[model samples]
Target: MLKIGEVARRTGVSVRALRYYEEQGLLTPDRTPSGQRRYPEETVEVVLLFQRFYAAGLSSRAIAALLPCVNKGHPSTPQRHMLRTERDRLAARVEEMADTLHRLDQLITDADRRAGAAA
Candidate 1:
């Protein structure tokens, strides 16, 4: 078993985030006699998964809803639908980013043309 600090360092997650995960029902850590949190080695992967889910724009509630299916290794139809919705959202975000990049490129090109004309 590892202490919470060690787990946080190993997983690159903050201690507060781990505590929040526990509060969110996403993680369950063993408690010491002194009331310190101790976690198994497997928890590092779970923390990483949480980080990935967060980075992918999943809300804590969505992640919580998805975790049971992951733990059970069987996604129900609704869970699959939730995942599809998230995927579509991500796709939309990517398109928005691409559009923003294209606009920035155009601005840069126009600035370059103006600079050339000035010279």
Candidate 2:
């Protein structure tokens, strides 16, 4: 077992964030007799997964809801639906970001061409 601080250090997450994960039902650390939090060694990977989920725009509640599916290696019907929905949303966001990047590239090319002509 690792202490909460050790988990945070290994995962590069804050102690406060780990506590928040517990509050959100995302992590369940064991408590010592003195009430200090002790986590399993696997918690580092779990915290990294939580960071990825957060980057993917999942709320804490969403992550909490999906944890069981993740642990079971299979999602229920509603969980499957939710996964699909989030995936579609992420796909659209990626497309939009790509389009924006293309537009910015075009603008930069145009500016470069204009600068070359002026010189």
Candidate 3:
């Protein structure tokens, strides 16, 4: 067993975030003898999952709706298909960000070159 602080450190997440996750029902840590929070070993994996889904642009309510936060199969085929579509959307967003970054870099370089030539 580990304390919530330890879990947060191991997961590279903040204690407040972990508590929020718990409050959101995505994470359920047990209480210690003194009412402190204690997490099981598998909690590390769960926290990583939460981090990934969050980074993938999922809101708490959206993640709670999709992930279920429990160890069970999904409800129906539609849910599965929806998850797949969301993943595809995330992939597209990644590509879009890369293109945007490239364009921004090109603009910066062009401006720098123009400034140097005018000087």
Stretches of model 2 off by over 4 angstroms after superposition: none
List runs of model 1 lying over 4 Å from the truth.
Answer: none
Q: lDDT by residue for model 3 over 4-70, one digit each (tens)?
A: 9899889999999999998997877788779999999988888898899888888888777776523
Candidate 1: minimum summed lDDT over ten consecutive residues — where?
68-77
Q: Rank the candidates by TM-score, best first.
A: 2, 1, 3
lDDT of 1 by residue, 1-119 (tens): 99999989998999999999999999999999999999999899888989989998899999999997767879989999998999899999999999999999999999999999999
Q: Which of 2 and 3 is ahead in lDDT?
A: 2
Q: Please give the range of 10 consecutive residues that has the lowest summed lDDT in model 3.
A: 67-76
Error of 2 at 90 (Å): 0.4
Residue 45, model 1: lDDT of 87
Tell how far residue 46 is off in model 2, in angstroms: 1.1
Candidate 2 yields a Cα-based lDDT of 0.92
| Per-residue lDDT of model 2, residues 9-89, tens digit only | 898999999999999999998989999888888888889999999998999999998898877869999999999998899
What TM-score fits each model? 0.86, 0.94, 0.75
